[model samples]
Target chain A: MMEQPNRGRANIVGNGSVGGGAYTSVRIVGEGEVLGALGCDTFTCTGNCTVFGPVRAGLFKQRGDVTVKGEWSGGHLKTLGQLTIEGSVRAAKLDIVGQLTAREFVETDNLKLQGAIEVNGLVNADQADIRLYGPSRVNEIGGGRIHVRLSRLTAMKEWLKPRHSTELSAALIEGDDIHLEHTRADIVRGNRIHIGAGCVIGRVEYSQSLHVARSAKIGEEVQL
Target chain B: MEQELISKKDLLEQMDISYGQLYRWKRKRLIPEEWFIRKSTFTGQETFFPKPLIIARIGHILQFKDDLSLDELAGTLSPLQTDIRIGAEELRMRGLVSEQMILRHAGLALDSGQLPFDQAFYLYVAEHMSQLLRGEITEQETGALVRLLRGQLPKLEGKLCELVALRTESGSSMVLHTGGGRLYADERTTIAASIHLDEAIEAFKKKLYAY
Candidate 1:
């Protein structure tokens, strides 16, 4: 167990190791855990790591598996592993390449996800571009520009899954420009709306234009 | 002329309002629930709004944001009217509707002096009698206008209605309708002027009280 501030670069390796302190750069090489709040400039974790408290960093990159039990905020966050956030996450830019499970909201200026994301709360971003690789669920999404699509792998996986339906479920999705595919939402509202293939929507209200794909199912479409 | 609609994105960008601000206003009921129109585009589901109405509303909210809270603004924006009183002299002074027009429509003689009008009576004149002052319709048309509004007043209660005036080659007429009921002036009347009855009344009051 190490409990001290590392001014420069701090690297932890091997199993059964715990590092807790503020550092300029933190690199967790193996199965390392953080017991206290950790603040760093550049935080990279290659092996599985569990952060017990909040984390604030300039740049956070996770390559293996990481779990944060408290709120997390950083300038830029890039995750390519199984990341579980128990609390909200605030970041300027978030790039996710693997699976993300967040209990609360995810607020970011720009979000680009090429994998799966599940959230109990809303995802509020200035701009969000998500390509789902598997079944993903979110309560609500609001932003300026939101584009969600299902990747080929996701479609294949859904076909192979035992469940009959694999569409992403969301209560509401609202934004300026919104395009969704393989999504099931109660209501979708925006300036320009496009419901692509494999979407089941309850109601849609738009001001300018509305285009619905033949494969999509919509209950009602109203132009204001 | 058909009004142009504005895309939600364009409206926010043009007004410099964030998504958070728009949703906050919506949650506060400052913006009517029906105004959030949903449509589908090439991209996905999007929201749209009536361009002029939303612009005016946003402008009013921003202009008075410092003077009033969001709740207060919503109150002012709402069509509900509890107590609205206007003196006949004030109405005449403001030139909302001419004395002769009121005398002819309401049958109030000038010699009887000025009297305060309730919200319904004031709204009736603001909606129908204003056209009389503008010389858009004849004195004979006032009878029909009065009967229509008088009949609808009780049904309206404190709710709002839209007064629509239509002008055709034959003549001009007025109509008032809430969501439930509709009253038309004449069969040949074509709609030329349309406005919210409460808004017309409020505008008249503002003009009268400005000085």
Candidate 2:
């Protein structure tokens, strides 16, 4: 398909609102609200932004807080603070340093998470690299390679402050190669599965190989 | 009517396929999302699939994975993605649809250029149902069925549904409804033939990809 000429740019300097439409780039510096569906090449939010409709962008960068009432589809998304998406998220690459709450599914080609995530639906990614800094929860995780571990910073900060929970809780986790630390799951299935330290898994199903840390607890193991 | 469902655990055991393969196929759209039925079981919530449908789909995937890439397999398995366009001549040459059947039912000439997937799908469904019914339905009724499907299938917007040919003393008519529901006819009317739209589409895809 031929690319259409961009509809221009929309920028919010302070507390402002803009009706959503196709744009070349959207830059929100302060509190901003998009009233309808947004389609843009680049969306950069510095403070806070609330989108009442779906978002389609090529590059989405958020520094503060953003809530999308509808689905969000983008190519490269990097968030430094918090993100709340009521609908599903479909992206090529997602990099988050803070918290993310998605009511629906979150699907990406590559996912890099450093903070926490709460997803009511499945989190499907081709390559998921998660370092939980806080308690995280997901219904199911399925993909090619899934690796979840407690963040190094979170581990080091635990000695300074009282211990804080930094783990991932999932009902089902399935992939080709999976290595999880500080994760609690009902079922873990993969070709090569490694249950790292502080993991409490109900069952482990591996086809090729399996390894469980001495500190990890597993209810059952089956070689498929 | 309720479909028989196989739990995910049981399906894995029965199919001898790993969870990774199943999830990967699902991600690739080889398996439709609607087929994944989640319900609360004794062991919390679990996923289930329509037994016969999932079995057949897994068999098809296993048969083709050796020869076709997952993306190509997805193109054939996914009915929602209908980017395939072919000329009537090619359709005849591939024998996916007989030229006589196309000419008689679709009323399209051999020289009619490239046919979009929707038109081709309508033609395929029409020919399939007519052939199945054979002498049970009249030629006029068959033509009416084809016309009804061609008009209404597009309106359904790719919903998983069924086509039912109904016959009564007065006349014969066709109805399309979402599948998995029992369509009852009064004593006077008889349900002549019923076909699942998804199954038909899968068969059509197989035929199209066979070449």
Candidate 3:
């Protein structure tokens, strides 16, 4: 049998110029297919797949999905599309566009996203989280509503314990109103913060108001 | 290698810019983290800073962050100087400058520290401060807050509590540790807190969040 060359098939490579709104098909490694080059306008991962080198996409805008049944490390992953996984999500730094629902911890310094972040462990968003889950440790350039599920948390510079007294990080939280669910530190000093019930902060230093809860617990002297 | 000594007030002053500017820029949507220094000595005091470029960076943020909000000014600002926002009243009684300025700023905004326990405003102050600045006098600012509270409940149990600070303005400052809102004291108000003692003396330190 002679080789029949199929025409009209476009092979998109790294240097190839694909038109806008293009849909590229990618084959998963099911029956032992080590897909070396991962380039696409739309990408998806199923079962166990491994990238020998690095994987780059158009920030999920090109539509890339990684179930990551195996291990995905090194480099960066930017998804303008939605990413949903129930596996161990680990990375040096990750930036996503869609929602991030991980069953593990997230440690990144630069993440500018427009989707919600729902993780089980600590979430450290260096920039902003349009939506969030659980307690976080971050150095924010802006302030957003923080939901800390843990009893207590701190940062190298600042934290979102917007209660009576929390620790400091070195960034500023500018919300006319902030809420510290509970307090349990040594000394808390800064600007204006509105605290709530069941808190146990330690050193209650400088701040704005001192709205105490009925069932709240306090330490020693409160200097206002 | 040895680093220079950077004062706490100057460092806080530098952060004041971004914290202030971001508030206006984002319109209460975002705020940056505070600047923190490592507590080298015991008593949770004695911080270390690279004095050469510290104040200059903080001054940069303070200079520019007057109206920039959190989302608008992320990498563009920082707290390098040490100008704390304490009044003259706080400077006199709790006059421990070199030891605990970070602890003083933990309430309102953010402070650059490692621990979060210091962030908790010991419940009493944090809760009250949270409710006080609501533009009205609720049940929160009426009874429990006006007087010094002492109880035998679990709230007062466990650790040995002490409220010793490292940052003071001069002798007086209007510093208030409201529940956990913003931390700002007028002239009569002095920023102070009570703590349950722990083995780690560094836990006693304060971190500056806002100005």
Candidate 4:
């Protein structure tokens, strides 16, 4: 038997196409170029999804894994299966029971991704446990427990480059209590790390737990 | 050139100000889009005043809310004063001593950076937050505005976020189990990450004690 969603609450705003029921519905858009949308007051889909327009669901639920091949901009994107999104996915909380794979972008307020996340482009999250194979911009992690194996952690302030630091091949943050660990980059800032290990840090600020494995080499002083 | 200053009361009258909104603004010192238009009586032609000046003053007023006087607001308003300082103690109190702390909290912090909500809400949230976190709540694992209402601070009962509200763990020193997932930690320098709870016991902390 199909599940029935709470009625009396239905909203379909903007331009898009929608389908499914309140408990077991599916509202999706295909092409990213399309300007319309598929909306439902309460959406429930057990099969597929391809939404390009804005989605507003009072209560949107799905059973099977949903593939967001295009960009998704809406209130919430909650799915039970692995969500493979190519374009940007913006929502309050993009909760996916399965793995979330974004080839291009994924931005959200609070993301609870059960499976591993692979980002080829930019992945910005307030609190996320992501596996980034490409570049990423993370604001603040709510649960400050991350597992990233990257080469370098470029300070955002420096990355913004005043359009003047052209000579600066890379940006290195210098200060006290800084740490750099397990990275491939060439610079180090405040308290460094012990994550991936064996990285060439440009400089050391204040690393209380700065560990240099036998495979790592330092060509500079340990202090300012 | 002649500059026009108007009375706040008159400006409110002109703007058709409601009692609740005005009271909320005055108490919180949060000026929204209309901004704090310096109103002085000069004959009777109404003016919107200089847009840029008012906007600039809006920035100063926000910073100066600590002091009731407009003069103090302008004098103490410094962009440099806008930095968030999570002391080492506070950082660990929230159980953020892990690698994922920054990644997870960055979103919450950025979302706050995006709260184009009226200044009043911001002040009410900030002030109450300072109070609740600094002194009220016992644990730092999670926080909620409702908890503030129960304490000395008034309640800010609003759905700040749909599934989540602004959260911080900068006060509790207990070992937290994020309920799911294991985070990488480096004992030396881990910063606490704030979570956006869903009307949960978050978003409040007592204003830090006056130094």
The list of candidate 1 runs beyond 4 A from truth reads A1-8, A156-165, B1-211
Off by over 4 Å in 2: A1-6, A159-164, B1-21, B39-46, B55-139, B147-211
lDDT of 2 at A122: 95
lDDT tens digits by residue: candidate 3, B1-211: 2335564434445454322333233232222222334464432343335454345444544555568744345433211112323322222223322222234433343334222222222332333333333323234332233223222222433334433221244421112222334445556555543322332223212322212
Candidate 4 reaches a DockQ of 0.02
Instruction: Give the best candidate by TM-score.
Output: 2
Q: What tens digits encode model 2's per-residue C-alpha lDDT throughout B1-211? A: 2456898878887998866678768767788787788898754577888785678789888988999999889867555444435567656776566676677776652234666566677767767676777756666776787788777776675588898888898877889888568998999998988889988878775665441
Per-residue lDDT of candidate 1, residues B69-169 (tens digit): 87788776655322223446556666566667566665552234444344335434644555544756666776677677666765675577776777878
The DockQ-derived docking category for candidate 1 is incorrect
Ranking by DockQ: 2, 1, 3, 4
| lDDT, model 3, position A60 | 27
Off by over 4 Å in 3: A1-177, A182-189, A220-224, B7-10, B18-37, B40-48, B60-211
**Docking quality tier of candidate 4?**
incorrect
Q: By descending lDDT, how would the candidates be arranged?
A: 2, 1, 4, 3
TM-scores for every candidate against the unseen true structure: 0.53, 0.68, 0.33, 0.32
> Comparing 2 and 3 by TM-score, which wins?
2
What is the TM-score ranking, best to worst? 2, 1, 3, 4
Backbone clashes in model 2, listed as residue pairs: none
Number of the top candidate by lDDT?
A: 2
Better of 3 and 4 by TM-score: 3
Residue-by-residue lDDT tens digits, candidate 3, A43-146: 43333333332333332222444443323333355655555544434343466655555555443434454444555543443333332222222322223322
Residue B35 miss distance in model 4 (angstroms): 24
When summed lDDT is taken over every stretch of 10 residues in candidate 1 chain A, the lowest stretch is A1-10
